[model samples]
Each structure stands twice: as structure tokens, then as C-alpha cells.
Target: MRVKDKIHKLKILRVKAAKAMHADLQHELNAMHVYCHLRGFIGDRDALAFARKWERNIIYSHIIYRSINRSSNA
Candidate 1:
């Protein structure tokens, strides 16, 4: 395949991977919230908020890693 076609396919794959990551994160956060609620350790809203903060950190790191990789490749 041509370089351009390969780059296009890679971009598509990246998007799909990002969407899958987001869905997986959401499911995990929901489960965490439920577990915390059942254990009476934290309120539902608080648990979700905590999970979301963790999620943001993960996403931010992923973005930084991607930028670093792009720069190094270029």
C-alpha cells in the first residue's frame, strides 16, 4: 500500500482505539462507583468525581505520549 493510504489507516485505527478506551474507562468508573456505594466508603457522586479525575490524568498522559512520539518520529 501507498504511504498515504497507510497513514490514513493508522489514523482510523487511532480513532477507534481512543473510542474504545473511553468506553472502557466509563465502564470501569461505573463499576467503581457501585462498589464504593455498596461498601459505604464514599458517596456515588464523589466516587464518580474521583474516577473522572483519574481518567483525565490517564488521558492527558496518553496525549503527551502521543505528542512525544510524533515529535521523535518527525
Candidate 2:
């Protein structure tokens, strides 16, 4: 294939990979939220906030998880 065609194919593949990763992350966040809510570690409002903020920052995600775990343990 020509160089231009190869570049186009790479771009398409990258887009598809990004979309798949996004879907996986969203699924993970949803599962975490549901688990926390069902286990009574957090209420509905806080679970929604956790799911929303989890996507924005990894450090914040860890903090939230630790807090929830600590609260549950206590």
C-alpha cells in the first residue's frame, strides 16, 4: 500500500483502539460505583460523583478508593 493509505489505516486503527479503551474504562467505573453503592460504603449521590471523577484523574481515583475502604473497615 502507498504511504498515504498506510497513514490513513493507522489513524483509523488508533481511533478504534481509543474507543475500545474508553468503553472498557467506563464499564470498570460503573462496576466500581455499583459495588460501592450496594455494599453501603457510599450513597447514590456519592457513587455518581465517584464514577464521574474517576475518569478525570488516576490519583483522585486512588484517594476515593482508599477513603471508601477505610470507611468500610471502620
Candidate 3:
């Protein structure tokens, strides 16, 4: 592709990165709600496991999003 096309594509990627970050944040928030609900219903060990799983998901998404943002900025 041409240089201009590459730049344009990068811009689109940046926008997509931002959108993905937002979506992940929303998903994480929803997971938090579920975690809270589960805390009341499930045993402590089960609740803790679910919380850890969701936390890892959120962390992974944020890491990916941050890496993409940083690369796009560079």
C-alpha cells in the first residue's frame, strides 16, 4: 500500500483501539456487577474464583488496549 494509505489505516486502527478499550471497560463493569451478585449467592471460594477470573479478563483486555494505544502513538 501507499504511504498515505498506511497512515489512513493507522488512524482507523487507533479509532478501533479506542472503541475496543471502551467496550472492554464496559464488559469489566458488567462483570463487577455479576461478581457482586455472585458473592451473595455462592460460597466464598466459588465467589473468589469467579472474581479472579473476571479480574484477569479485565486486566488482559486493558493490557491489550494499552499496548495498541502505545504502538499507535509511537
Highest lDDT scorer: 3
Off by over 4 Å in 3: 1-20, 23-42
Candidate 1, overall lDDT? 0.52
Candidate 1 lDDT, 1-74, residue by residue in tens? 44345335434533554555435545644554454455453544644464455546546646766788789999
Point out where model 2 deviates above 4 Å.
Answer: 22-74
lDDT per residue, candidate 3, 1-74, as tens digits?
44345335434533453456666566655655564454352455654464555556566768887898899999
Could you tell me every candidate's TM-score relative to the true structure?
0.43, 0.30, 0.46
How many residue pairs collide in each prediction? 0, 0, 0
lDDT of 2 at 56: 52
Minimum summed lDDT over a 10-residue window in model 3 is located at 6-15
Question: Model 3 clash tally?
Answer: 0
lDDT-wise, the better of 1 and 3 is 3
Please give, for residues 15-52, the per-residue lDDT of candidate 2 as tens digits: 44334532455565555556445545454464446444
Model 1, position 61: C-alpha lDDT score: 48
Global local distance difference test of model 3: 0.55
